[model samples]
Target: MGLLVFGGACLQGVGGLGFSMFCAPIALLLFPELVPGPLLALGCPLALLAGLREFKAIEWGTAGYTLVGRALGAALATAVLQVLSGPTLSVVFALLILGGVALSVQGWVVRVTPAASSAAGVASGLMGTITSAGAPPLAIALQDLQPAPLRATLGCVFFIGSVMSLLALAAAGKTDAHNLLIGVLLLPWMAAGFFASGPLARRMSRTGVRRVLLTLATFSALAVLAQGLLHSQA
Candidate 1:
């Protein structure tokens, strides 16, 4: 349990770039039973806290569409994950994030506009559903914005999505007694991460943050591939 808590905090802290790419997969792998249930439940707080810490920086105008996109994306993910094998879904999602990271690092991040919001939202909904991977499209959509607003909007979208997701996952019977127990056990770690959000944001510039996120995405890709390989061998 201690290990799970630490794993959650550390993975999220380094390079998830205000996203849940690494944290969600790690949570599912380490505690499969709690995934999309307690794990998702707990993760929302981390995103919420991170976003709020940079509230002043949030690009309030475009944030709403991102939230709407996230809600739709969460719905789509819930549907897809219901039908897909866990390993397959994880690997696919990992690849998606890896691609986004690669594109960004290669200077391919397209400047986002309101017109891109709907399309990005659709993609965001689909990917985020399977992997809690809610950052890719939003990153593109918010690319033109400054770091403060960018991260802030991400925080808001994630928080909103987390709320919607919790409800959706709960309605689907993903949440249960065991899930609650895991959440309780992980409260301290979640609290600690939330507490540290301010300091974490101050530690990096936007480009630095994006680079870190891309790095994490690469690591996530390898991790997913490894899992697939291990599962195949098994």
Candidate 2:
């Protein structure tokens, strides 16, 4: 688990949105308790570090709009948890992410306008709340940005979104002491990955970063899909 967290953090450091994408699937399969809550907890500081690394490049306006939508989405997801099974929602959202990825590959440009950012935030909040892998939507929405700004913006958005999701999960009684403890334990690994990412992030071009973002997004959706299927079968 430490190795896994470190690897995911490294990816996120480079791509601005990969920690959950890389870790959530395996965590769900093995450490079921280290998800939506624990992982979200870990994301808070990881995101903060990334945001601070490129603070000057952050798109503050986009972050603001995304946060507003994230709040609403988190609320709705909390309510949905009362009615839906986690595996069921996971399957549904995974398909949605795959669909979004498909459209993006087909030359569909998701402009990072206020409305689009908010929409992405909604999807991100919903997915992040349930699956702990919400970066795909926002990453897709902001793919057109340059590497530094993209990373900075995503970092800011994710830090706040993770906090909101944590609160919502806590209110829904999904988070507990065990999850928090696991998150705390994983911090050192995450930090190692974050620091290691510096050199890689510096070398990546805008195009390279976009490719990494899309590829990771697709992988995350597939991982979630596999997890959902396994859970349903189990």
Candidate 3:
């Protein structure tokens, strides 16, 4: 679990996304207790560190607009949780993630206007709240932005969204003390990953980082698809 958390956090620190996306499905398989709550708890500090590393580059205008859509989307997802079974939601979410990744890889470009930001945020919030795979929408939406700004803005958006998701999970009675404890324990590993990212991120070109990020997203989505398949079989 520590190694997984460290690897995922390293990806998050370098690409500004992938911590939970990369780690959550595996955690669900290995340590079911470290999910939704504990994993989300780990997100707060990890995102903050990643964002702060490139703090000067954050695009506040875009992030602000996205927040509004994220809130609405999260509410809608909560409603979905109430109506859908776990297997159903997992399958649906995994499909959406795969679709999002396909669109990104195809170079589908949506201009980073306020409207686009909001749309991405809504999608991200819905996905993140349910599947812990929120970054793809925002990542696709901001694919054209410079790496520093993109990473910083994404980190901020994720940091805030993580808080909101945790609160919602708590209200839904999905989070508990055990999850929190596990999340807290994982913090050290997360920190280690973040610290290790500095040299690596600095060495990689922006294009390289972007390619790596998209590849990671693709594989993460596949992982989710596998999880959904297992759930359906069960």
Candidate 4:
């Protein structure tokens, strides 16, 4: 778990994506307690770190527009959580991950207008609140931006979204000391991975990094979907 968290965090530090999307599926298999709650808790600090690191590159205008959408999406997600069963939620998350991957690979040139930004934000908020895997939507939305701005703006967006998810989780009684302790325990690993990312970030092209993320995201989503199927069968 620590190693996975470290790797995911390192990737996020370098590419501004993949921390939760990579970690959450594996964590669901290995440590079921650390899914949306602990991951969201951990992501708050990790995202803030990235946002601060590239603060100058952030597209604040887009961030504001997306945040407004996130507010709406998070509210809807909170409502969804009230009635959905665990396996159902897992399946929903899996589909969302797969859908995001499909959109990314399709080469659709979506203009980042305010309307699109808010729509993407709403999607991200819903997915992030449910699965802790919101980056794909935002990543696709900002794909046309410069790599530095893309990464920085994403980090800032995630920072705020994570806070909202954590608060919602806490209100739903899904967050507790156990989840928080797990998040705290993984901090050092996350920090180590983050530092290691500096070299990798310099070496890899943005396209190459995004390709890797797409592959990992697809695999993670498939894995979770399989897990959900098995759980439902059981």
Which candidate has the highest lDDT of all?
2
Residue-level lDDT of model 2, residues 1-234, one tens digit each, is: 899899989999999999888887788779878777888899999999999999999999999988888877777898999999989999998888789788888988687899998998888878877776778888788998889999998899888877776887899999999899999999999999999999999999988898898899889888888888988899
Residue by residue across 5-110, what tens digits does model 3's lDDT show?
Answer: 8998898878878888788878877988787788889988898887899999999999898988888887788888898865667667667666866776687656
By summed lDDT, which 10 consecutive residues of candidate 2 come out lowest?
Answer: 125-134
* Clash tally for model 3: 0
Q: Higher-TM-score candidate among 1 and 4?
A: 4
* Off by more than 4 A, model 3: 78-93
**What TM-score, computed on C-alpha atoms, does each candidate reach?**
0.77, 0.87, 0.87, 0.83
Ordered by lDDT, highest first, the candidates read 2, 3, 4, 1
Q: Over all chains combined, what TM-score does candidate 2 have? A: 0.87
Per-residue CA lDDT of model 1 for 1-234, tens digit only, reads 545655555445433343355565665667576566676667677766657667787766566766666567666776776798656876776676567666776788766666566567767787666545556556544555556776666667667777887887778886888888888788787677655545665676777666655565576566666675676567
Estimate the Cα RMSD of every predicted model relative to the unseen true structure: 3.7, 2.5, 2.4, 2.9
Q: Whose TM-score is higher: candidate 1's or candidate 3's?
A: 3
Worst 10 residues of 1 by lDDT: 10-19
Task: Write out the backbone clash pairs for model 3.
Answer: none
